[model samples]
Target: MSDTITLLYAQSVIWLVVFGLCAVIALMFRRVRAFYRRIAPLGALAPTAATIAHLPTTFLRSFSGSEVTAGGSREDGRPQLLVFVSGSCPVSRKMVPIVDDFARRERLSLLYCGDESDEAQKRTIATLGLSESGFVNDAAIGRLLGVDRVPFAVLLDPTGTVQARGLVNNLEHLESLLGVQETGYRSLQGFMTANPRALTG
Candidate 1:
């Protein structure tokens, strides 16, 4: 009986040591992955958004089905921010106020994009109080921009150049578009490539 108890105790200690080692390894691995993600190019981690360098030259339609000439210098000479959303998406609905606030704060001309039906789009426009000048309910724009997901955003300079474009689910993501613009790089990957010091910083 004494020998059996000692063996059981030893086995338990061995298992505990193994579990502890695994926990330490998991923690270290997570830290390393996080560090890598910070240093890696923006799109390299998990594709949060497409790397569209410039706004494709194309004509866009408003939610009211009116022709709107896009891809040229803005009349107001301010940057434009296009947010892709779906009227049916709960997250999109949640983002309406946040996006509005961000656009107003950033001095950006905010535009909303979606691929929902016209009736649904109309309802969404009315429900959200979106300006006709700032609403687009077309799939063509999403195709042109290579947007594979909803809740994506593209920031354009006054000259119609893409300053930054990415998937924005929260304020941090929305704000990163501005941060990317400040770096003077059209994309975060380009910024990291040119500014290697950012890794350590």
Candidate 2:
């Protein structure tokens, strides 16, 4: 009887250990699931207020009467970067030098889009030290590009597909568009969410 009780007690202990291990495993799974939920990819990059990505953009002509296509066939086959700005906007003025440098470094076909008067636009171009050839005088172009704010930027692929578009007030914001293009992520948030391990590991 004592042996029987000992055997039963040992069985009970084994079962208890098994249950405890199962509970521990379950808790670990729950924690892992919670972590994944916290880092889940977001759709914030696909904002309703902005133009959709991967869509062909409309073409526009520069003030110089040269065809400045955004997302269509061009003889150069180079990617285009369009920056919408206003001559009177202080933020736009501040970004001019940065945009100019970026364009030169990236070898992108840069175009400055603004609704300012011809003289004001010319002055802004000269002050910014950008090529007059890169200035497109059409406010309607902004509407077509779905730009609602000044200092907005759009990066188009060689095929004229909108690769990235956002409000760029500083160098980081502008560079993030290139990051999105190269990483195949829509936004910085999307990148962090998809690669949570990159942050922790």
Candidate 3:
């Protein structure tokens, strides 16, 4: 009986040690993941609104002279994509093309919020060859939207209901926000192919 008790105690100690090692490994992996995400510009993961829960609001005192054209006469239609960004944010700069493509293909309304100078704004517009049809800027809009950071995007339906909102750092997150299920935004071709039929009245 004494020998049996000793064996059981040794087994328990071994399991405790194993569990401790696993916990430490998990912690190490989490830190490594965070490090990689920061440097890699995770254009693949979909971040939730909760991630920006601590983000600050815009501090601009005045609005730009540039006007943002509100699109669609329809009382009910596709969601509005509001992107808050600045010329300095690397993530926002990278997502410019993604937003442009979404606007063109989906024929959705898009609004960009920031306190950009007139010359810089004009250059950005020209560089992107953006359609004046749907683009707009209002720094105050960020305050109303509770935005304080760059590279932020929000999705709102025609009824002004927020559908999905988050940081536009990755294609996956954008895809999910746009209501792309399954493989989400990663499967852009499949989405475009199936979207028309899904929306047909």
Candidate 4:
């Protein structure tokens, strides 16, 4: 009868809506998987294989006009996190705030260094809204740590000993660098290799 037809039509409409929602979810999942796969390769390039060595003592000046001694013990009594960046690098520019946030969260004295020209450096400082402190424009700082790449990071203990150094392209890479302090491994890959339990645990 007419009543039965009405009920069947309503059911058909409900099933169509459910199918549409499912299809949308599946499409979104595929996009997420594709994005993850693209970034996975970039993450694999981090935590360089070269042995990290102690940095030589060097004197530098901060953007805030403070005399800073880098790569050596300081009276501050805190670990140092050195981030080697370039004014011209898009990745470095995009990471300024992120690096600052990470450093603050980790309670590490952070220093930003680059070899770009004075103009470019100033532009980065202004564009990134970096407070006129904790930024070093000296090229020597990077050279002292044998940092031949931009967007590199080095974590040094309070005594100025290098704990970890790596090329960081994402937050995950930065987290793994800090993990070195606990696992005594240069990279998470090394840690997983030495401790298979890392995979499950």
Candidate 5:
């Protein structure tokens, strides 16, 4: 009878250990899922209704007669970086310095397009220390680029292909657009989805 009880107790202990191990495994999975969700780069604002990626963009000249080509042969042979901003948008104002620094550092062909009047566009250009030649007063370019939000950016490759485009609220967000292009992902979320192991590693 003692031997029987010992055997039963050992079996019970084994079962308990099995259940505990299962619970631990489940907890680990939950933690991993949470980690992925935390590290996944997602934007608060959605993209414009029109899809801009991989599409040819149209060009319009700035108010100062400087050629603003979005997707075409570049005279300078440098990639173009088009940014949409408004005079009334505080976010756009905040991004001016950041954009200016990026433009100078990257040597990108930068164009600041907006729906604001020519005066307002000029004022913004002056405030940002960007040349008037780089400021476009037309809203049509923004519409064609699917930029419904202020402080939006679209990076075009040298061959005039849309490399990346998105609403940018900060420098990190702006860099993520370039990251999307480098990774060949439509967005940061797409990158994370395809490479979940990246986060864990």
Candidate 6:
């Protein structure tokens, strides 16, 4: 009788451990499935150049006053070009001159949104001649724009939909989205890099 009881106890302990391990594995599988589901939307999207030309309407709210640029003018119109920069990002510096020139020429409506309290940021904007451009203080615009990193630019229609987006560090991705034949645009790589950031929390 004593031997039987010990065997029963040992069996119970073994079963419990097995069950716990199964539960942990199941939980991990569920988390991975959820991550895949979020990004699946992008996979289903056929990122053709023609489809990319039309700007999609953005779902975020617009800024109303001095807090943002063009009196929130960029927000009210169709998807316009939006760029995000940080006071410390070197890549942003490389693109600022291009952005300022693009905006000044009115080739596209550009909005430069960045961290507000840094005095150097003010100087950076002034130096770039974007002081009167549609400057916004909102970080959400960047997130909403699906920007996961700095030195990024997006061509938005007046509706706020992202027509095209990429590292514009070379403007190749930008040109591709616009359907222009640029010598060095890598649309695939840009989309691949930005897709992960767009779907993740």
Q: Each candidate's TM vs. the true structure?
A: 0.66, 0.62, 0.49, 0.67, 0.67, 0.47
Please write out the lDDT profile of model 3 over residues 66-108, one tens digit for every residue: 4433322325465567777666676777888888777667676
Model 2: CA > 4 A from native: 1-48, 51-59, 117-123, 188-201
Give the Cα-based TM-score of candidate 1 against the true structure: 0.66
Q: RMSD, model 2, all Cα superposed? A: 11.5
Residue 7 displacement in candidate 4 (angstroms): 14
Model 3 residue 92 CA deviation (Å) reads 2.1
The whole-model C-alpha lDDT of candidate 2 against the native structure comes to 0.74
lDDT of 1 by residue, 1-201 (tens): 999999999999999999999999999999998888777334311144444456744577886678765555878888888888876677777788999999999899877888878888887777666777778777876766667776788888888787777677788778888877667865566776687788775
Per residue, candidate 5 scores C-alpha lDDT tens digits across 19-92 of 99999999999998888876756542336643545436466677778665667767788878888887677888
Model 2, 119-197: lDDT tens per residue? 8878777766656667787876666667777778888888777777777878878777887878886565667768877
Per residue, candidate 6 scores C-alpha lDDT tens digits across 96-193 of 77666665554676677764554666665665555543565555555555566666776654554445566566544344546521312334445556
Sort the candidates on TM-score, descending order.
Answer: 4, 5, 1, 2, 3, 6
Ten contiguous residues minimizing lDDT sum, candidate 4: 39-48
Task: Identify the runs in model 6 with alpha carbons over 4 angstroms from their true place.
Answer: 1-79, 103-106, 115-120, 123-129, 180-201
State each model's C-alpha RMSD to the native: 7.0, 11.5, 14.2, 5.4, 8.8, 14.6
How far is 190's C-alpha from truth in model 4 (Å)?
5.7
What are the lDDT scores of the predictions, listed in order? 0.75, 0.74, 0.58, 0.75, 0.74, 0.56
Expressed as tens digits, the lDDT of each residue in 36-76 for candidate 4 is: 76542222133345433676567788888998776677677
CA shift of 113, model 2, Å: 0.7
TM-score-wise, the better of 1 and 6 is 1
